[model samples]
Target chain A: MTDPVAQPETAIIVLGCPEVPVQQALALYVASGLRERGTDVLVTGNPSVLGLLKVSDPKSVYIGKTLVLETCIGEIVERKRDCTLCIVFAHNDAGIAYAATMCHLLPKSRVVVVVFGKDPEPLAAEINFPCETITEKAVHNPAQLKTKITRVLGWAVSRT
Target chain B: MGCIENLKYEKILPLGASFKECREYVEKNYPEVWYVEPGYKLFDEYIIGLPPIALGIENGEKITFPYTKPCHGTYLLRIEGKEEVERVRKTAKTKKQAGYR
Candidate 1:
């Protein structure tokens, strides 16, 4: 019998509220980087965040597929959907909560949390789970976060 | 009694109580209730205090979860009714759904 072809890995990028300026830019950058690695990427967020992302990438060049945040969580909870890797972009306590929740839900999958804002250290400290966490203090400029994300992508690729 | 605006009943946690503290409280006080872990997005608006962590009972008929308002604080809301419970249950992984065997 012939050897079966392996399926590409899948990744879900969970985004927090769209108010933070760096979130949208970092999300797109990460999605693009993941896509370049031949991984299936899905960016999920609230309607407002989705609207902003869609408007930014109207042609869906960087963002391949998008799902509503609640719907995505529902699917995971019901064991209807899953991914090889889950990345959460967080800036506040709520973001930390979301990341912690994702860790519980996807115990088998690798979860990476990208914490950024005025005080990323304190917010990142709130996460008390087993996952790769990246922290940077970037509000309007995506440079710092972008570099950290690039390193994360490299590390992720090396592992898988 | 005057008209009840909603069917939901709530008990707000004391100030400075963390999510872990709230979960411990539920486990100690309401041992029969099973809780979904923190991080489930139960509300439409962005939660500023904590992620929506809920405790389910009565075969998913009655649920008590934490709901936080920006600058207001978090509340342990006890909502009765199967429909609402189902809605909350669908948002995050539960004990059974988490493959507790």
Candidate 2:
């Protein structure tokens, strides 16, 4: 059987812990990128970001566990739900990607992980996981925001 | 990130790209003048050749792609939006297969 980890495909889950508007803005932009592509964009953030995203009765389902820690591995696996993308958000100088590099059980083809940062150095990439793909997008200013939109659409169009 | 209200480490750091790849991107883009120390090491690991071709870029700068097993992978490095990836094509590089098309 083909290794499931090698082919990742799922909803884009923006992973990050946001405390400031600046950080939330970047993550939101990236999430919007995927959503614009018609792909479901799921944001996995802390209470601050989650609050910002607005936890409605429907979207407010508390995870009660973190996928990274495998706290509910069996349950998450069973409820992996049809995800087409997964974007892990981060801030500048943040190590979001660093932490993700250690995960081994991610379903291949059902995920495209990203660690959003404050800056652009690590923006838009394919690295880390042996079989998985990840990208980093940072939009610090208006010019960068435009670039971010262009690059994101480029990615979506290319994927299509 | 410094002061002005120190954000929690978890809030600052989110696991995403591998450290190796992030470092590679930094070395390829940032101006050579900005390199401090380890930047030179990254250049040595990810850069294609001695005196990398992207004009105006300095030499022997810092690099952070530490030598590690399975570190051999194809990387597209560009500076000022221009690529210097061709300069570092070694005979060994030819043997590596492309991953994540």
Candidate 3:
């Protein structure tokens, strides 16, 4: 008998508040990288952030599935949703809380916290849980974050 | 008794408890309550504030959430009653309105 086709691994990219200028760009970059690696990507965020992403990727090039932040959390809490990888883009206390919650809920999934903002060190320090973390002080320029993301995802840094 | 400042009975988790701790506490103590996180859309508005997590009990009429003040700490507050719950729900957008499939 022929074996059934296996589903592709899934990765969830949870975004924080959109006030930070680099979050959207980095989120797209990470999603694209994950997709290129044969993993399905779902991006979750607030209305403002989702709206920005929607307008930015009108053709659904980078982001595949999009879910509201609360809905995604609720699904995770209820065990209705699961993924192979979870990446949280954090720049504030709330982002840390979200990442911690993800860690607690998805014990089996690999969780990575990407910390950025005016002061990422302090914000990254607030994470007391066990998870991979990448911190870089960035706002308008996403190069630092991009490099860190490439390293975390095992993608080669683009020369261009 | 005149309208004076006073205290009321409520369950408060330990100070400096993280959102994960608070969620676990509520889930263990009040398993029947609905777990809610930040950015949850109520009626027309979203739950956006400090601490970023909450519990809904009594069919969501009472919302137990963490409130943090600068230099103070995080405290769990339960607001009971249909009026208040309805107020928050009305301000939040529903899943349909939020374009959730």
C-alpha lDDT of all candidate models, in order = 0.68, 0.34, 0.69
Candidate 1 CAPRI classification by DockQ: incorrect
Interface RMSD of 1: 6.8
Per-residue alpha-carbon lDDT of candidate 3 for residues A1-160, written as tens digits (9 for 90 to 100): 3332232499999998898899989988988877876898999987789999999999998887899876777677667898988999888766776777788777898889999989999778887777899999999999988987776666653322
Please give, for every candidate in the order listed, the TM-score of chain B alone compared with the true chain B.
Answer: 0.53, 0.22, 0.50
lDDT per residue for candidate 1 within A19-53, as digits (tens), equals 78999888998888788768999998778888899
Between candidates 2 and 3, name the one with more favorable lDDT.
Answer: 3
Which ten contiguous residues of candidate 3 chain A have the minimum total lDDT? A1-10
Candidate 2 regions with alpha-carbon error over 4 angstroms: A1-10, A20-22, A55-79, A92-103, A110-127, A131-139, A142-160, B1-101
Candidate 3 has an interface RMSD (Å) of 9.2
Per-chain TM-score (chain B), model 1 = 0.53
Tens-digit per-residue lDDT, A13-73, candidate 2: 4444544244455555555554554554445543544565554223533221123212222
Which whole-number lDDT from 0 to 100 does residue A70 have in model 1?
A: 62
Clashing pairs in 1: none
